[model samples]
Target chain A: MLTPLTVALAVAALALAAWCGHAAYRDQPTKDWHFAGMAVVTALSVLQLVVGVVRLARGEEPADSTVIFVSYLVGVVCCMPAVGLLSLSERTRWGSLTVVAGAVVLAVLQVRLYDIWEGVGA
Target chain B: MPERNGDTDGSTGTARAAGTTGDGGRRLASGPGRLLVTLYGIFTVGAASRSLYQLSTRFDEAPLAYVLSAVAAVVYAFITVALVRGGEGARRAALACCGAELLGVLTVGTWTLVEPSAFPDATVWSDYGMGYLFIPLVLPVTGLLWLRRQPTDGSERTDTTSRTGTTGRTDGTGPAGR
Candidate 1:
């Protein structure tokens, strides 16, 4: 995984989480703007996924077991879209809160992915 | 008061009945329950996949820990499904699962602490889910509280309805609508 891209994704996820959490506290459902924000995060995740795969295809091995790293990579990629769809079904402040939770999870997963990648060489 | 009564009676009777029986009542995936379901779903996936990978790849390293992780994953999956299905039966099942989850976490946590060598690696509940931000420790407690708050039988519904009526009479709009 690209270190800079991973760090960027974590920051974006947390920032979006905080934003959604504020919206939830204000008793607002996930608005269009929230979807847009999620889209940006999801786009970043997709980019990471593509870059990781491309690098792997070109003989770049992760620091650890390829299975575990690949699993986490897929997980990070899928997290936002799943949570976003789930939140869409809910039309209350809790929906926004769900987005916040999803973002937080995504951020954590990204950090884990980074650690796993780094763990192999160090 | 009469207007509020008429409105609730006309519109919400089915909703109330469904909520009570889980036949057609409010879905467990509705409102705040939605949030709970989402969290449970995440844990279900996380625990299940993690355990599967560990058990398949390195079972010899820590058999006990991997088994416990698998158990935790199953419990999480059951609870998630029960919460989503809703109804009295599902609620009871969820409550039971939550209770079991709490018991498991406490038991495993204390066991690991009292005998650190017992777990060479870590189960999901080892150290009360420290690796997972203690969510495994807190989640069951929250599940129990949320389940307890759900109206169970007819009597509870009547009690809530009466309370709604009293508030509606005084305020001219039932507080329950929101």
Candidate 2:
């Protein structure tokens, strides 16, 4: 995993979380504009996922087991889209809160992803 | 179903239900239930994945811990499913499951604390889920509070029966419907 990119992704996820939290505070559901933010973070995470996969394919070794690392990589990519869709179905401030949950989770996952590569806690 | 369904049994909810009954409909996953589901789903994945990896690669290192992690994962999964299913029955099941989760966490947390030597390594519920920021301890308590606040079908039916004088609460103003 790229450390800089992961950091950037985590920052973006937190930004999205804040944005969604604002919407939830305002008693509004996540609107189209919020989804644009979701797309950016999701795209970046997916790009990171691709990079991680390519590295694995080239027989580059992470600091730990590939399975744990890859699961987290794949899991990061799934968080926003799943939550975004789920939020779409909800149409309320809680829907916005749902996005907040998703974004925070993704941000945390990003940190974990970085740690896995750094073997910080492995 | 709105997460902020405060005074849900009062006249305010009766008035409010007129507007949101279509979506929330008193389902378990409506309103704040969505938040609970999100949290529980995340925990399920975290606990399940961790336990699976540990059991596969290092069971001998901490068999009890790994098994407890798996058990916690299962309880989390059951609660998630119950919330999503969303009904009086589902609510009751989720309520029961949350009770079990709290019991498990307290048991495991206390066990690990009282007999530190018994747990060579940490499980999710160790020290009351300290590794996970005590979320394991906090989550079940939250789930239980939320689930208890939700009006069951029978209670809602009794409520509606007196007010609406409706014979079919199954389709009419819900004992469960928002």
Candidate 3:
């Protein structure tokens, strides 16, 4: 079951990805706006991790807790930080594009997490 | 490749005005290079972490595939570092790693297809990187191509100088049209 919050977050992530891709080819500097979007996505991902664990603890059955938890944790910890660091190093429009790539990866992981929750594999 | 007085001066001034960044010794790596490096970093971390988790949990079930995943992870890590480093040393390392990756995906991808029984489950290159939308397969080729386009001396031989008339593109690729 997809929640409104999750859907909204996914949309935002996708939007960020699109913007980053557009900015990369432009060869402009990635101003603060790109970072801000990444920061927001990071916060939402953290929230999702908390909520996901809580749901699992409340006698909820998932397809595989191990895979689900790992995907969530990695999405939160690795994707955002890596993107941030890469963007800073870029110092160009491509920096923003890096952020966008991270967002898309994060969003895909989010979908994978949801699939894990449903236990479709089971 | 040769160092200039203004370039060694450590200012975006006459150095960049003369056309270049990070000292005239360094050439314009370009926005695309940066973007490509960023993507490689993401994949490096993503693939490495996933492989580690998979290996730690179920080594017994499919040792061959999981081990290959770990190898792929290491290769990606190497490539990421090389790409971001972006110098003579880094470029050579990156090209080598990219070449390895291309071979790996192709060989493993075909091996998996031919001998499905050998691999109980999927690896990163199991189906020619179907899991990653074939990006894993394509990235190496693209990386090699891009690296070839750059000067081998690890200097910014062509900065905005060649494209000065069109200042629209700072990297000398083309006008970005921001």
Candidate 4:
């Protein structure tokens, strides 16, 4: 895994989570700005996905189970979009809260991916 | 839909009736319940995939742990579906699932703490879901609370009557009364 990219994704996800958390606490619905923030995070994840696939093509395999590593890579890319759609349907403070939860989950997944990758390489 | 129906007198009575059913039972996916559903959905996917992968690839290493994870996945999936499909029956089913989930988490959590050697690997509820920020432990508690807040079967009549009274009086105010 790309260490810098993973760290960047985790940081971005957590920042978005905190922002959405504050909005939810204030009883606000998810706004266009929230979507924009999500887009940025999703873009980062997509980039990571592309880079990860390229690395795999170059025969740079993680030390752990390749299946698990691939699954996490794909899952990291899917998380934001899925949560964004779910939040869009909700249209309430709870919708914002959902985004907050999703972002935090993404951050956690990123950390886990890093750990798993490190485990294999080490 | 209720908001639109509240505009027409002809539809008001029917809409009010429907609203009573809705508000009384409180659609499991409404408001805060939506958040619960989303979280449960995440857990269902997370636990199910994790358990399935572990069971398929290395079950011999930790059969008990993988099996427990699979069980948690099934329970999460059931609760997620029940919450999304709101009704008297769905509410009851969700309530039962939440209760079972709470018990499972507590039991497994304590067992892991007491006999760490028993689990060669961590299940979803191990250490009270410490690995997942304890959300696994807290989820069922919140789910039970949310399910309890739904009007009971016996109290449906009273709930509908109270809801009808409020909606009936605020006809001109539109859906704002809701």
Candidate 5:
């Protein structure tokens, strides 16, 4: 659950980042399709979050502190929606750039999530 | 590959923005300012939440680091608000805050370097924000430059014209309209 799910989520996140990066490069706003892409990544994160929370409920615990581990899990799920709302309000090239920032943050959070779960950097 | 239909009626982007402001014009939260706001908003949330969690759960482990993270979150929140407000007063406030933020980063960064034991846990500005890819160090400088480029009260018209004309150059890519 940990390794494969993190990989899938990080890949989805980076894919959204690349899509938004192209939009930023072309100096365009985040279009409907970009939102669609974010939706995909976000839905996957929601699934990941459910699985994580269920595991914790069942008696599974992360290698690190459960507090920060749960925080990272929750953080991944919120990133896309927050950026989506933000980019929607702006409606400019910077809006697309905002997506890029959010997606990159999401990706990095994925890595940190895995690290926290595995106690790699702890 | 190029999708150009990003704006609706695109004609009013620059003109509408320019006309709406009061005597002191030039929105700092325009083109690049939007990106800055997004980044700052993220940092505000991230740092604030992390610090609160750390302070609540493990105050005994590293009080100094958590306090610094809380301070970083406050500064980020201030800058995010200033950018979103988009007025002369807000711009100056952001500018002053950016300077203070840079000073904080430098002070914390050097202190951590000189005395690593003081920070058993990491603060946001530890070693110049290396934990966060040095973005904490770079962000203040970027905010400073962006705020400085904005037109103040008396120099509104000419500053707007010149910068908007060449804004794309400074921006790397994108229209001057924001």
Candidate 6:
């Protein structure tokens, strides 16, 4: 049930997380590369939200459309932005680490979204 | 007060004092603390919504599991607030909640495995939060570890400095030391 887009997003997010985690352990600052990754994540998340809404409108039913859509919406529009802003404020290694962690969460939530769409659970 | 900079402000002056004396625990409250709070807020909303949905949809199906989800949400919410508020009292509260979260996850994880029938549905702690990729399990441990390493009073000074010579702080005294 995973779309090609989702797969690509997941890989990209994971890669960003790995890079960010490495940088964090090295006690580095929040690099421009990390911000670029977050921007990608944000863009992809918005795409996913739009896709979800379209699917719902097209009669594609999830196990719980309300919950599924809400989760996705929150993750993209609210949670991700808030985390990104806070990390920028910190401007430390831990701040970068937070971005890394948030990327991981975003990837996992994408998986969850896929499952919800397909009406399955692991 | 309005024109006073962060370092010079009398209100924030306590933070400087705390930093020098290792008592201004609020440093984290503003910086990395806010980031953590944001994450916790997401978890709080997720867990709370999930639990409420479970309860409203099927209270009779798995009361214990659903109730635990609600508890997890409350803990996340509390921790988020404590981290944002930033003070000795807030830190204490956060420490207690984080500790309880760790214990709760373990206990519920074990209970669910041993008594599957007891939990017809999944709680945040079920399967040691495998559903959440065990972040639930790891977060509290990290929070508690951070809390323990923090100065016992209310200051934010730790002795573990990096090579840069900056005082011991969470990020290892920046890249200058490295």
- For B88-171, candidate 6 gives per-residue lDDT tens digits of 777778989999999999999999999999998899999999988787898887677665555555434444222233223554
lDDT of 2 by residue, A1-122 (tens): 67888999999999999999987887766777788999999999999999999988998888878899999998999999988877765666766888898899898888778778888976
- CAPRI-style quality class for the chain A–B interface of candidate 6: incorrect
Residue-wise C-alpha lDDT for candidate 2, range B114-138, written one tens digit per residue: 9999899899999999978788999
Cα TM-score per model: 0.84, 0.83, 0.78, 0.83, 0.86, 0.80
Q: Rank the candidates by DockQ, best first.
A: 5, 1, 3, 4, 2, 6
Model 1's TM-score against the true structure = 0.84
Candidate numbers sorted by TM-score from highest down: 5, 1, 4, 2, 6, 3
Q: State the C-alpha lDDT per candidate.
A: 0.79, 0.79, 0.68, 0.80, 0.80, 0.70
Better of 5 and 6 by DockQ: 5
Clashing pairs in 4: none
DockQ of 6: 0.14
Please provide, for model 6 over A1-122, each residue's C-alpha lDDT reduced to its tens digit, 9 standing for 90 to 100: 33887888788888888988877677654555567777887787777678777776777677755665556656654545666675665555666677776787777877786777666773
Q: Model 3 in CAPRI terms: which quality?
A: acceptable
Q: For each model, chain A TM-score?
A: 0.95, 0.97, 0.83, 0.95, 0.95, 0.86
* Residues A1-122, model 5: lDDT tens digits: 46798898888888888888887777677778898999999998888889988889999988888888788878888899988877776666677788889989998998888888777887
Clashes of each: 2, 3, 4, 0, 0, 8
- Measured over the true interface residues after superposition, the C-alpha RMSD of each candidate is 9.0, 10.2, 8.6, 9.4, 4.5, 7.9
Model 2 chain A poorest ten-residue lDDT run: A86-95
Write one digit per residue (lDDT tens) for candidate 4, span A8-42.
99999999999989777666666777889999999
* DockQ values per model: 0.33, 0.19, 0.27, 0.27, 0.48, 0.14
Candidate 1: clashing pairs of residues: B18-B25, B19-B25
Question: In candidate 3, what are the lDDT values of residues A40-71, reduced to their tens digit?
Answer: 88787777777766766776666676664656
**Which residue ranges in model 2 land beyond 4 Å of their true spot?**
B1-26, B154-178
Candidate 4 chain A lDDT trough over 10 residues, lowest sum: A113-122
